[model samples]
Target: MKQNRLIQNIILLIGCLLLNSCYQNEEYMQTVQQNHLLIDIKDSGIYSNEPISRANTVGYTTTFSEGDKIGLYAVKNGEILPDVNNVCLSYTEGKWVANSSISYSEDKVGAIYYAYYPYDQALSTFNKTSTDPFEALVSSWEIGNDLTGDIYTGKDLMTGFANAKLEGRNYTLDLTLGHRMSLAVIKLPTTTYNFTNAGMSSYNVSPQNISFTIGKDSESEAPILPYYDITSDTYRILIHPNTAYTLKGKFTNGANANKSYTINIGTDIDKAQYAQYIVDQPEIINYTLNIGDYYCADGSLVSKDGPAPSNCIGVVYQVGTTDAIKNDYPSCNHGLVYALKRVEGDPIKWSTSKPSSTNWYEKYGMLLYNATGVDIQGYEETKTWMDIETGEVEGVDINSIMKSTLNDYRQNFILPSTTTDWYLPSYKELDALNNNATILNTQFSKVNGEALWTSATKDISYWSTTIRRQDAVVQYHPDNKTKAGYIRDSSGYYRYSFGF
Candidate 1:
């Protein structure tokens, strides 16, 4: 009876074990069929010009650059899962792996998820993790708010949401990261000039740096450091998505000056990008003079239209479009005549002496530049200010000969005016003055000034800087507007005109 009892107990125990194993198998099968959550993540956008890594530095990317990270939030049963709140889903190995596991209970209707790139630490403690799909339409982003993180180091804020799609027993949530922010690429116009050659430290005429304001700018301050791409010569600035902004930066001349400008980036910057080419030109032509204005002794123009100032040296009579008067005035487009009033004593001759080394001035009649033809207009007009400045009569420029005491032009320093700044006016420039002689003479009278040409009939003529090699020196007196020149050795008064 004892043996039979032992055998029965062993069989009962074996049956219990077999039953338990069968139950475990049933449980495993049930677990396999249970609904679980899964996600397939991707980025959706165009390729960017500023590449930070595998993804664009400006954050407009359509593919994941390995090692990219994003915050994942899951919602089930109309409530955001506590464990999935701003949970970091880092791209690892070959897949996105979550630090903490999250699964939807079978009782929940469907799983919803919101994911965004460039996870921020501040978002973890935020209490409001609402499950609304439109939660993105309005932002509570202070600097890098919500789970959006507003901006990455040099990237746009990418956010996207999707409803879970069911695949048999698994709920797969697909999140495609996208963003709406202005990607500003500021570039200065390519200039051929080397600014450093002209005493400048750094001559790239570009904005120092760019900063942006979200909303009204009065609401909050969000300044971003721009990424400069030297290869492309571009500066990239990322603005907060969907917010009104004003991008600001001071345009500068190397390290010299600051030029301020305000550009409104209202809703227009939504998901768009632009390349602003700053129109900057280094100064080579400075225009400050106009006809009928007081030309200062120092070659500066008086602001007003009429009357001469106490420092007046000459009156402006002509402007550009005339090469006859063009000279070494590096900062001006116009020039002034020297000593508005002529000779301290009385009118003098063109010269009392000539160079002793040679009688070339006597034989050529002092007009060496127009040696070949004096009758033909083009041939006779071959002379320019450069010829007199460069041509030397016995190793002496014509200007030095004129500045000599033997000539009528004074060498003494005229108060408020430097006689050195003066140059004898050419025939074309003298003609230009002749055209406006009446007005100039009128101004001279008003300023207690004396002018060379008082009128057309004033037999009182002034010496000119022009000379024909075959003829005598030219005179300021003109017989007609069309004549090439008039050469007369008759003693004449003298005045000098200066190029600004």
Candidate 2:
């Protein structure tokens, strides 16, 4: 029984040794899988062979050798394999690196974990028992050009490449160089002065002193430079950054008078400012008068000869035997002092009588008259008269007879005055007079049906001294006479005289 126990102990000793060897191998594989140099290909099925396993070693890893065609398989779940159907291969540092052609499948855990590393053709395959083929390949390969420039570098098989510089580094790039600038210039309308009638065709005006301020808005805090030119009495300004500017000009005239004008130099100038520059000039003020006509409120017209001291054109009238310059008269008599007619319309009657006063006749005391007939009650009174036997007298104070006869004449004609200034009207004055023939015939009476003579005459004949058509020849009379017209029968026959 002791001999049987010794044999059993030897068998136990062999089993313990084999168990220790397996445990050591497993631990070494796990350590290789966790190496930093290995690109994690566990989730990348980039080859059509088995994953990195103890069973397949040649397809999972490769080493670079001249003219070698090694197929690289991606790792998936800590195993290198050639089972990746959708896989692609690329060269890095003269070695074939592998990656999955398709994006990581969302259903797989850690599907983004894929990797490859520099490899060589000589070491054509990984050991069958090795767990990390990517780490092993990296350790055996030499680095080459990473393809990305100085800004980036390759870090690991799975971590691919990264920007090698620090964050927030500053850089500048010129998009375009040696470019030409384009500009637009808008000219404002100009003002001109002209004097056509005054014999001035053109006049010279001086250029105005002006200034401009540029800004973004009317108010902005940017430093801007301005450039300008003045040519042909116009101002041209250019401001940097193509912004808005305010412009002002000061102008002075020959008379030393000064004025200021403001404008805007921008895309949109104020409309009112532009309009003010286009204003219209004012008109001149001067004129003349015509001759031979009197300037009146209504207009000009032909004038007439009038009186002196107050040289105004007085109205004209005719004189009759019965007309008088005094206001008092016979109770039944309504005589005229002078007969007048208006140049406009029908004749208007006027008198110098004082209302409600008996001293009216005394106011016209300078008036005188004569008569050669019978004695009348007011005879010596020199203001009344009576018919007496006729006698030829050169001059007589037959004032009473004349006054009474004059009173009768005044009452029947159009008269303007009763003062002694009343005289027989002139020819031109009478001709211009306005008269109504219908009224005149009805107002006057003729004794013995005889027309009496007036103070107005032509040559030896007693002719009416009224003007006609601005001429002196035409006269009115009852008897058509060559040189003498019958006034009354000399005591029995008709007689004529040159005096009224």
Candidate 3:
């Protein structure tokens, strides 16, 4: 009986060895050398293969820190493996480690792989957007405010997957996560001086589609407000691919309070993967201002050739008011008003004059003063300099001249002014004047006013009301992208402007 038992044991051992040999002949069979999976995380925005620091990644994706989670799915033979479904991994130090690593078992080998960031335990399965292009539905992910929340992760959605053939013992995947969303960086105009604070008046969004243009499904839209970044003074929205949106802007201060702008972001919006909407002045106000209107000192505009209002100081030679400025001074007809003449007559030698030599020009070596915090748009800046602390500032002098010396403007400047006060124009104001010099000059001649641009301000730059830290930014006539505007000038003409 003992001999018979020994013979059966030998037969069983031989059968087990022969079974292992048969398994080796299969494609998924592996040599004993390799067993673990090797995965690498990458940002497809920067699009790199060789390992690089996270800083090199682009757009909202920062360097990965410890504890960041990743979920993976390994599918084989048209179905996901039971054990490897939604496997969670964590980033530690500089490597991604798994809770229980997927082994190079025959079942796990020769399989397709899919990976997603911010692993959620509840997400058992996710739908694919398309099969041919291998797109995964990122719609399930909700976009949070990047400014208020974790700026790097929640706002952006990323995915990594592989659908190609796999036949190796050890599974290796370069899981480069690609962005499936778009960015809309909406910037308010700098001249939106009236915007003490910002708010969204209207926001609407439609479901994302594979095509660039979304269907007319207004009833199925969602309300999504773009994240407003106070630091940059801009609005940012993280949008799913080909998602249509509509944004209307309103500001806190009076002008923007009364007025609002609606922008329909539809087919015109660039909807490519990882694409960005343009940063531009989408649309200005819906009003127009004719050049050569009589400008009252109180910041009001009278029709061309009409009787000047009480305290009329000049005529409207330029209509370059920004949307924000238009919001502030509607009485000015959303245009710029230049005085009939410059201050202290001809351009002085800057400092030798009483205004220049005063503490205003106390900054050494430089011609302009170091007057700080003078960026107010309308009456505020003039009030600070003229302090109309008077004798020292031109605002007082200009007011006196308009009321007394300039006979025609004296009553016009005094007519219960809508703008209420006048001051030297800011840098932006001056540029607005210079930009339309041609149209302004023609109107000025017809209205019998000083030539908007004379030989005095042509070759050299004029002193702009905008002065900062010994530097004066003037309107240079280079007219090219390199030198369109924003140049400093030592020579200047102190000219007063109506309203702002």
- The TM-score leader among the candidates is 3
Worst 10 residues of 2 by lDDT: 173-182
Model 2: CA > 4 A from native? 1-200, 218-232, 253-257, 264-500
* Best of the candidates, lDDT: 1
Per-prediction RMSD in angstroms? Answer: 22.5, 49.5, 19.6
- Candidate 1 vs candidate 3: the lDDT winner is 1
Instruction: Quantify all predictions' global Cα lDDT against the true fold.
Output: 0.51, 0.27, 0.49
User: Lowest summed-lDDT stretch of 10 residues in model 3?
Assistant: 202-211
Tens-digit lDDT string for candidate 3 (8-67): 999999999889878876534455425666677887663211134333432344467888
Task: Give the C-alpha miss distance for residue 91 in model 1, angstroms.
Answer: 1.7
CA-RMSD of model 3: 19.6
lDDT of 2 by residue, 94-128 (tens): 54344543222223223222323322334444432
What would the TM-scores of all predictions be? 0.37, 0.15, 0.38
